[model samples]
Target: MAHLLEGNFGQGSGFNECLSEHVLLTRFGIGINDPKWISIRLSLFKSITLPGVVSQNTSKLGWFIFIDSSWPSEFISDILLATKDFEFIKIIKVNFYFEYYIISEKLIAKSIDFYGRCLVSKIDDDDGISLDCFDVLYDLRGDFFACVFSSGYEFLCQNRIFKPSNMPFLTMNTHFDMRSLDDLKYLRIGHHRVAEFIDKERRNLHVQDEGRFWVYSRHKYSDSRFSAVRKSIVDDKKSRVISSADYHHFSIDFSLLQEFRSQSALLNGVPNEKTWLRQADLNEEAEKIYRQLVSMKRVIDEVGADVIQ
Candidate 1:
């Protein structure tokens, strides 16, 4: 019984139990031939969207109806062909039935600003816009519309309506993470040289601190060459050189050490790290690991890492 309980007990079982308790199973008796009863139960779990209801900001309307992005295009095409039954279309419509049209001219304007293309065009003839112009514009924004449709469809399929598009057409507001090209160009070289110089010096200190009788042969050679390269890149007067000892000590500190351990655990089986360290010809796994540790520190600052634990 203990083994059975242990095997059966899993996340979200409590909610399932509550649902089963509230819903009278006897009302729809177990009848294998009665398809309508099955349909009614399925509909209960299906997401319902009403027209003209300005959904709350948190709604995840009709997104589960689309194919997964990881699925190959050919596979998706085949799925669409196989599931061409009008009943499926009706299901989608039932899930996302909207009575009132919501115009988003402002949203469309924003998309044009960020994407450098228009999706919505005026129907008036006096605008001098030809069908060719409309076609070209539509072609450019078609990908965007398709994405929206796919997301909407998925939401409906999952029985959820009120899922708002993050990039709503007709809204002129856009969000983007913009970084200067110059900043990106120097980031890799700057970080690499600095970390390498620090690591070598730390290793030499570790050898000396071990207090072996033999003279430190490795200590005779100055790791200063790497340090010099790093210093040369420091154009800002305020920038100062940080030693490997400083970083080593920082890593061992109670707060930082705890974070390092957590990050190391998180990265344990990630294949990308192995590929990056081995195949990418980047012989700086230690440096990469340290960089990730530093990034985790920043994340901890934004959202307390204790919460995750």
Candidate 2:
């Protein structure tokens, strides 16, 4: 994630410029210095995101987090302290949104030079994957291809609900396979709309409905917290109340719910217990502009597949 930076939204969509401080405050609802927003985000990062990522069965992966350099120093310190125990979890501070792509390209080039192939994956700050996601990705690595782990559970935190979601092209990470540094095209784009860039023949859509391989959570601070489209997908009648048994099944720490609840109390007394989506005219307008600003687009030129030596 670019972490509140204005990145390339689409090929023709003009959102590459760094957002003004005024726009940031309006788009995100809370300023970066807001204590309530920081508390909620940190709570989710620690309680929900880190546990499953740390539980990965394989050590053959690197998790890079791109956070804005202008974030509050105290907040950055908190993040560093939280991730201190995990060596593979790197916190990279970027001055601008587009800088991450430039730095990531160098990182990918180094990987390919050393290993002859690399797999680039992506995940959100508030989402997680199965303990074996990296293991599966490394096992299925190849040249000039893509993979999506389509089976996952979508959790609504306020309501404490878990729904079985079966969507096409759902992935935690490793959506693109890079056989050489020229494969940088695959790494430059976001995970949502691969079909627009990669042809149907080269992309592999892995659907494993029998097992849940990822966890997508929705909370008040989420970027899509006000999105009705997201609501329709995960808030179905088929969703069930989450329980202790499901916690173990999803590789989530049992204490996550309590931690989130306590954090909610700190933020706003947990008022929206029944609904995570807060409805308001201003909120709707902000959400609309936010959606328009942060869109999927190809960031680099396409590089053809590498020739076998």
Which candidate number would show the highest TM-score if scored against the true structure?
2
- Per-residue lDDT value at 18 in model 2: 20
Candidate 1's TM-score reads 0.13
What would you estimate as the lDDT of candidate 1? 0.22
lDDT tens per residue, model 2, 1-309:
222222222222222222111000001112244556666767676777777777775356566666656568787788788878765655666443444555566566666666676666766667767767666666655533666677777877666778877665643633666666666875555456666666644455443345677778776666433355347645588788887777765566657667877766555423232222323344457546655544421212233223211
Error of 1 at 125 (Å): 70
* Sliding window of 10 residues with minimal summed lDDT for model 2: 20-29
Score every model by TM-score: 0.13, 0.69
Residue ranges of candidate 2 with Cα displaced over 4 Å:
1-34, 170-174, 200-209, 224-235, 265-309
**Candidate 1 lDDT, 25-86, residue by residue in tens:** 00111111223222222222111111001121112111112111333335334333433431
